[model samples]
Target: MIMKAIQKYSVVLLLLFIAVSIAGCGNQKEESSAYSIFYINKDITKIVKQPYEPVADITDTNAMIDEFLGQLKTDPEDVEYKRVIPKDVTVLDYSVEGELLTLYFDKHYSSVEPVEEALVRAAIVRTMVQIDGVECLTFYVGDAPLSDQSGNPIGVMTNDSFIENPGEQINSIQTATLVLYFADEEGSGLIQETQEVHYSSNISMEKLVMEHLLEGPKSEHAKSAIPEGTKLMSVSVLEGVCYVSLDESFLNQDYNVEEPVVIYSIVNSLSEISTISKVQISVNGDTSGVYRDSFALDKIYERNLDYVDAEVQGNVIEEGATEELE
Candidate 1:
């Protein structure tokens, strides 16, 4: 039944790609799920989990994505902890080919302006695949994964911990380090994390930052907003602050209005999850200078630029603006 649904809906849902559906909230609860359903991002493909939703031992995928955004809201100031890198982004279909889960972004996804090709590859893939159960991930923008503008394969990295696992079975647990492990046909095990990577497991710091308005340690806000296949890349703890990095494609997605909701939940979740008091965020890397469709956003001359290459383009203008020549 699952395979049959994937084959049928995969083409139809993808082919008739609509921009946005404006449904009335009054009728929202009463409406059938088919009509009430939303497409997360145009390039992203989401097949709703009907009978068998993905079950995790430690945390469900939904909680992870939402908690990330929540942290963004509570601690917006902590967001700029790391120098933000700018990567060109696009949303693409997500598919599982054997043991690997491939996340495809738009075709221009690989052309990052700030980080080099090597750093882009490591940051995007390693940060995202750190989630439980996802052993290996291949990133594609459009039909092509990690390609430059000219359609050349550039940033593809295989997981060091990949075991040749296949096929899915029932949900069960293997205890080792408060982890929820599931078995695949291949030899590797999917480990789920319940407690935050903090000193204490009993505390709900992770829950507070995640904004679990509900009973469980899940995110109420961001989960309902972005489409599925969205993953939290990395939350770094440095000197009493949490620095979070995210997939570049996150900025290119389609939300009805106020897209920063995605970011807010992430930052807030981080503030709540761990002992860190502050949180900072950057999409793919670029901070104040990030623009979506390419505007001539000049780099502001801030006092604390660490790299020292802060110029309009790349030149160092020691004096003020030069006079126009005839």
Candidate 2:
């Protein structure tokens, strides 16, 4: 009887050891899926990240993103960390294309203070990009991509877009030489001009080019091609195509600038960037219609020197458009 009892005890020990080993394996799986969720500090100056592990087995990318967004809106147990999404702001929806994730928020999102807004963007981008497939994110207030008070689109944002500074480093100054195209004296041809500009580092190069074009040409020989009060809704480059979206104001054409001149002005200017090979302009994300009568907004445009004035090629342009000609 004692021998039988001893054998039974040995069997129980083996079973217990197997259970413990299975539990250890489960914990390891959870750790592999763990990621950091970022939140703003109570002072609203910067963001803090906290490691989070999901309670359930969530292998779907959409489900994982949804879980992360829910966490961002939830108040952390730690008093030092605050919820990044403002109470008034509501994430209406989200979608993912390739590696880009876009979050659509209600109009109230625009009400976030500039400094706090920068932190919020940083928190979201840093948190979301941790997902296995997502690499970048953008916020959309209603149909328009998020913009600053000056009406320039914030464009696509990645982990490097914001610096963690209490004072908000989004306004940090950086300089770039912009190659811009404007109409000639007759408003029938493109005249390229170069400008050295000090702009916010947060702004993308594509949006910067559009902003300067809207601001008009600084040279005496060049004229404004974009219509007045045209707000750039958004600008982004993917697969060699620069996608440009503008407000309805862009449809209000300056008749003095011929159709091709106005269209190619934007195309040739943006094409100066090595990454951009084609440009597609749209009004409020609608590319179905034409810009005027001939230039279709739906069509993708390559750099067209056909409308560029011959004089522009020979003139010393400070090396902006001239280099692209070569």
Top candidate on lDDT is 2
Measured by TM-score, the strongest candidate is 2
- For residues 186-263, could you state the per-residue lDDT of candidate 2 as single tens digits? 898888788998665455677678778888988777788888788776666767888887778888967888888888
lDDT of 2 at 57: 84
| Displacement of the residue 122 alpha carbon in candidate 1, Å | 16
Residue 213 of model 2, lDDT score: 89
lDDT of 2 at 281: 87
Candidate 1 lDDT, tens digit per residue, 294-325? 32123211112121112321221222124223
What CA RMSD would you report for each candidate?
Answer: 25.2, 19.1
What is residue 272's positional error in candidate 2, in angstroms?
1.3
Ten-residue segment with the worst summed lDDT in candidate 2? 16-25
List runs of model 1 lying over 4 Å from the truth: 1-222, 226-229, 288-326
Clash list (residue pairs), candidate 2: none
